[model samples]
Target: MTAGNTGRKRPTISDVARRAGVTKGAVSRALNSGTGVSTGTRERIRLAAVELGWSPSYAARALNGKPLGTIGLVVRRSPEILDFDAFFPSFLSGIESVLSGEEHATVIRFVPDAQTEAATYERLFGDRFVDGFLVTDLRVDDERPAMLHRLGAPAVVVGAPEGSSDLPTITNDAEEAIRGLVRRFADAGHRRIAHVQGDRHMLHALQRRRHWEQAMGEFGLEPGPVEHGGYTIVGGAQATERILARSGDERPTAVFYGSDLMAIGGYSVLGEAGLAIPADVAVAGFDDIPLASFASPPMTTVRSKHRALGSAGARILLDMLKGQAPPLSTVLTGELCIRDSSGDPV
Candidate 1:
C-alpha cells in the first residue's frame, strides 16, 4: 500500500491527473502557475496528488527553470514567542487554508536576528527553493522589501504600508481601532489613562502608541504615562507595577495594553494590588485572542482580522506569481469589543 514497496514505481503527474479525473496539462497548470484551471478542479487535483503521495521533483524543476511551487515565510522572532503568540497561529492557519487547496507548500524559516533573516531570504530565493514570500512583522527600518525587490522576488507584506518600498500590503486598521479604544476610555470619565506598549521597533507597536497619544489629545486629555511591556505577560505585570508605584492621583484610572496577553499579565498585578476591575483601574488590550473572552472578567480589546490578513496576503502573492496585478494596498478593519474589563458599554 506504500510507495516504498518492491516493484512499485513512483507516482507520476499522469497518475495524479488520472486520479483527479483531469488532463495532465490541467494538473501542471494547477500545481505550477495556478491558471487555466478552476478553483474546484485545482483543489481536486491537489487532493488526488496528496492521496497518491505524488510530489513534483525539485531537481526536475531546477533543470527546467520552473517554479518550486513553494512560498517562503521568514519569521524573525524567538521560538518561545511564536509558541504563545496568538496572532501567528491564526495567521498561519489562514495561509494554510489557501495554499493547501492550491497545492502550494509553505517554507517557514525562523531566524534569531536581522542578519541571518536577510541571508535566509536571499538564499531561499537564489536557490529556487520558493516561488514567492509572505513578509510579516514590519519594523521601523525594514529592509526586506527592498532586498526582495532587488532579488526580483514576488512577495506580499502583511503589515502597514511602508513608504520606503512599493510592496503590496494587507494591513489591518489598527490605528483607528486604537484611537477608538482610547475614546471609549475617555468617554467613561477616565481622565488618567496609561498605555502599555510592545517593542518600539515594531511598526504596529509604534502606531498604537502614536494613535493613543493623538486620540488623548483630540479628547483634550493629556496622555497618561507609557511603559514598554514587550508584548509579554510578565512584561505587562512589571510595567503595571511601575505605573501603580505612583501616588493615587498620579496613577492612571485606566490602562490599555498593546496585546491581550499583556493585558492578562496586568490582571494579576491588579488583583495582587487589591484593585477592582473598572472600579479602580479599567483595562483594555489589542488582539482579541481566544483567552480574552475567557478571562475572569471578559476583556475589552480590539479584534483584528489576523486570519483574513494572512489569507489575503497569501492570495495576493499567489496572484503575483501568476502574473496578475493585485491591489497595491488592502486595509482590513478591526472592531473594538467592549466587555466587563472596560465597564458597561457607554
Candidate 2:
C-alpha cells in the first residue's frame, strides 16, 4: 500500500525544510514571506509543508511565558436551565470582539448568586481555571471584588464593585443616563412622571432610582410616580396597573422603564387602557434593545453601552494581569436615543 493510506503522524518544520532542500531558517523565511527567500524556494517549502501536514507548535510557543490565550468571563447571575440564549448574546459578542486583538477567548459561567460566587473562586483560584476573571452585574455591597483581590486574582468588573480599592471596574453611568430621561420629560412639560424600576438589590436599579429622584426634584417637579419592577416584563405591566388606578390628578403623564423588556410590558398595558402615547401618557425605557425601534411607534429611551461595557471590562482585566496600572474604574456615558415613545420633541 502507498504511504498516503497510512495514519502517519504529521511532519515537522524541519522535515519540510529537508524535503524542500533548504535550511530551517530559509524555510521559515519562505513561510513568513521574508525578503531573503527566492520565489521558487518559497513555493517548494509551502508544498512540502502541505504534503507533510506540518503545523506550527503553539504549545512550544506557549511554554516560554507567552499566554496560552484565554480570559475567563464570570457572571454572578444564575444559569437558566433553558437551552435558549437569553440576554448574553450582546455582551458576549462584545467580549469576544475586544479579546480578538490578543487572540484570547472567553470562558463564560453564571454562578448561583452571591453565595456561590464567593465559593467558586475559593476553589478555583490556583486551579488553572482561567487567566483572569470578568465579573459582571455587580450588586450593592458585593463581595467578589474583595474576594478576588484577596486571592490576588486579576479581574475586571462590569459594574462598580462595592468598597473596592483598586480592582479595575468598567461601568456605564446608569444614574446619569436615566436622569436625562427624567430631565427630558420634565422639560417637555410632563411633570407627573413615573419610573418602573428594576430589582432594588442590584446596583443598576439603585443607581437609576437615585438619579430618577434627584433629577425630578432638580426641575422643581413633584415626586414622580415610582414602582419596583423586579426587572420583568410581566412585573412592569402589573406595576403599570398600579399607576393607572391612581386618582386622575395623581396619574402619571410620563413613564420611564428600566429595560426594553419592561417597556414591552408597559406598552402593552398602556395600549389596552386606550391611552394614546404622548397624547395621554408618554413612555420611555433603558437598554435600547434591537426590538425597541420596532415597538409600535418606536421608543424614546436610554441605550446602555452593553457591548462596550463588556469589551472594556475584559481589556482592563487583561491589562491588570500584565502588571499594567489600568484605571481603577472606567465609566462610560450612554445615549438618550429619542424615539416615538416619548412623543415628538414638543
Candidate 3:
C-alpha cells in the first residue's frame, strides 16, 4: 500500500506496539537498536508493520507540517538472497543507532531483483517518503551513484563508485586488506592458498577477490583456485568442493572464503567427507560472525568494519538531508583475524 490508503490519522508507534503485543519502550528499542528486544521480536514487529502499511516517514509527517524522517535502504539481492544475517543486520543496527540518536525514522524495503534495484533509485527522487537514501550492494555498472549526482538528491551509498564523482559513498580499503591478510597467512607458513570469492558482479566482491589474489602472489604463492561464489554458504560450498576434488598435487593446502557462512559450509562439506581441518586442508572465512567462532573447527576470517560502514552512510545521508555538500566517498579498513583454520600450517 503506497501511501494513499489512509484517510484517517496515521498509526502511531504506540498503536503499532499495542497491536504487536509489545510495550512502547520495546518498540522504540527495536527501532533504535537500544538495549532491549530479541531479534525474533524485532522481526515480528517489522513484519507486522509492513502488513499494517504503517510508515513513519517525512512524507507522512508532511501532511501536518510534522517531520518524520526516513532513511531508505536499497539492496540488489535476489528474493533468495541468503545469509543477509551477516552484512545487513549489523549494518542496519549501526545505521539505526545513529539515526535514532538524532530522533529520526528509517524505512527498509526490498527491490524486485537486480533489474529493479537500479530503478528503485527513483524512490529517493520522489517528493514523499524519505528525506534521504542509503544504497547498498553496489556493482560494477551500478548507475545509481551517477544518477543521484545528476538529480542532486541526498544519498549515502555503501560501496565505492567506479569513477570519481560527487556522491557520498563509503568503501572498504582494498590494498591494506591485502597486505594484512598476506602477513597473517605468511606468518602461519601456509604456501598453497585458494579463495572462494563473492559475487564478481559487485564492486566490493571484485575488490576483495583482487586483494586475496594479490596477497597470495606477494607472498610468492601461486594464486590458488579462486572461484566467484555469489556471497552465500551454498555458493561457497560449491567452490570448496571443486577445489577439494583436485588431485593432491593440484589441490590447495588452504582455503579463504569470502564470508563466514561460506567458510562454515565448506567446513561442513569437508567434515562429511572425513577431511580433517588444518591437518589436511586449512580453512578461513571473513565477517567474523559469532557462528564463525562456534563452528566445529572455529573458522578464521577478516572482520569487515560493517557497523562503521552503516554509521558513515547514515551520517552522510543526514548531511545531505541537511543540504550540506559532503565528500562523495569514504574508505574504511578491515581487521584480519587469525584462528585455528590455517593453524601454523607447518
Candidate 4:
C-alpha cells in the first residue's frame, strides 16, 4: 500500500517502490546507480519519486555505502569578511547549480584561524558528516590537502600550489592577464604603475603580485610600489591612502588592485583626494564583479569565471565519488576587459 500523503514523515524508498511496483532493493539500486535496472524502469522509478516528492535521507543513505548527498565548504574567515567579499557568493552560486541538479546539498562552515579550520575538517570527516569537501582560498604551504589525504577524505581544491600532489586542483592562469594590463598602462604613457595586493598568504595573490613585478621589469619600467591590502574595502582604502601619501614624481600614475573590491575601495580614496580616473591615476582590478562597471569611471578588470570554477570543482568531486580517475588538474584562462578606468577601451 502507498503511504498516506498527510503523514509527518517524508515519502520513503518504500513509497517509490509501491508507486512503481518494484521491490525495495530494486528502488535502492535504481536511485543509487541504476546499474542492474533497465533504462525504462529507472526512468519510471525516478519519475515516481519526483511525483511523490521523495528524497533519500543522507543519514539513511550513508549506512548503505552511498554518498551522503552533501558537500562541505569550510572557510577560514569570519562572517563579516565573507559578507564583504563578492566572489564567495558568485562562486557558491555556480557550485550550487551543479549540486542542485545532482540533488546534493552544501554545508558551509566559517572558522577564525588555521587551527580551528583543520579541527573542523577533521571533526566533519570523522563523524561522516560530508561525502567530500570543496576547498577554496588556498594558502601558501597549505596543510589542508595533506590533512585530508591522511584522513582518506575526498576533496577538490580551487587553487593550485607549487609541488602539490594527490588532490585535484582547478586554477586559472593570471600571467597573460597581468601582462595585458601592464601593457595597457605602458601604452598610455604610464611609467609608474603601483599594485594594491591581496593577502600574501593566498596563492592567487602571490601569483598576481609576481606577474606585476615581471611585467614591469620586462617593459623596462621601474616596478612601482606594492602594498598589501587584502581583498576587502577597508584594506584597499588603506593601501591606496599609503600610495597617495607619496610626494610628486614619487607616487604611481596607475594602480592595479588585486581584486575588484580593492579597486572600488581605491576609487573612494581617489575621490577623497580629488583625483580623476585615467586622467590623474588610472586603475584596474581582477575579478570583474557586478559593481566594477557601475563604478564612477567603470573600472577595468580581468574576467575570470568564478561560477565556472565552482561548477568545475564540484564536477571533479563527483567524479571521484564515482570511483573515476579524473585528470589531475584543470586550468582556466582569463580575459582582460578594458574600460574608462584604464583609459579608452582596448
> Candidate 4, which ten residues in sequence have the lowest lDDT sum?
1-10
The candidates, ranked best first by TM-score, are 4, 1, 2, 3
TM-score, candidate number 4: 0.94
Residue pairs in candidate 1 whose N, alpha carbon or C atoms collide under 3 angstroms: none
Q: Which has the better lDDT: candidate 2, or candidate 4? A: 4
Per-residue lDDT for 1-346 in model 4, tens only? 4666565677889999999999998888898866789898899999999999998887777687678878899998777765767668878998999999979889999999988999999988778889899889988888888889898899998887768577888987778988999999999999999999999888789988899999999999999999989898889999999999999999999999999999888999999999999899999999998899999899899988788999998888887887888678899898899999998533
The sequence of per-residue lDDT tens digits that candidate 2 reaches over residues 1-346 is 6766786766877899899998998986775434598888888888898888786564653554444456676666556522222246777777888777555777766786667767776655455556678876667887777878888877777776556555777878767767777777876789799888888778878787777888888878876778887777788899899999998788999998887777788888999999988779899988888888899879888888888877777777777666678887789887888887886555
Model 2: worst 10 consecutive residues (lDDT sum): 78-87
Superposition-based RMSD of candidate 2 using all C-alpha atoms, in angstroms: 5.6
Candidate 2 has which clashing residue pairs, if any? none
**What TM-score would you give candidate 2 relative to the actual structure?**
0.80
Strongest candidate by TM-score: 4
Order of quality (lDDT) = 1, 4, 2, 3
- Estimate TM-scores for all models: 0.91, 0.80, 0.78, 0.94
Off by over 4 Å in 2: 1-68, 81-87, 162-164
| Superior candidate under TM-score, 2 versus 4 | 4
RMSD of every candidate to native, in Å, equals 2.9, 5.6, 9.2, 2.7
lDDT against true structure, model 4: 0.89
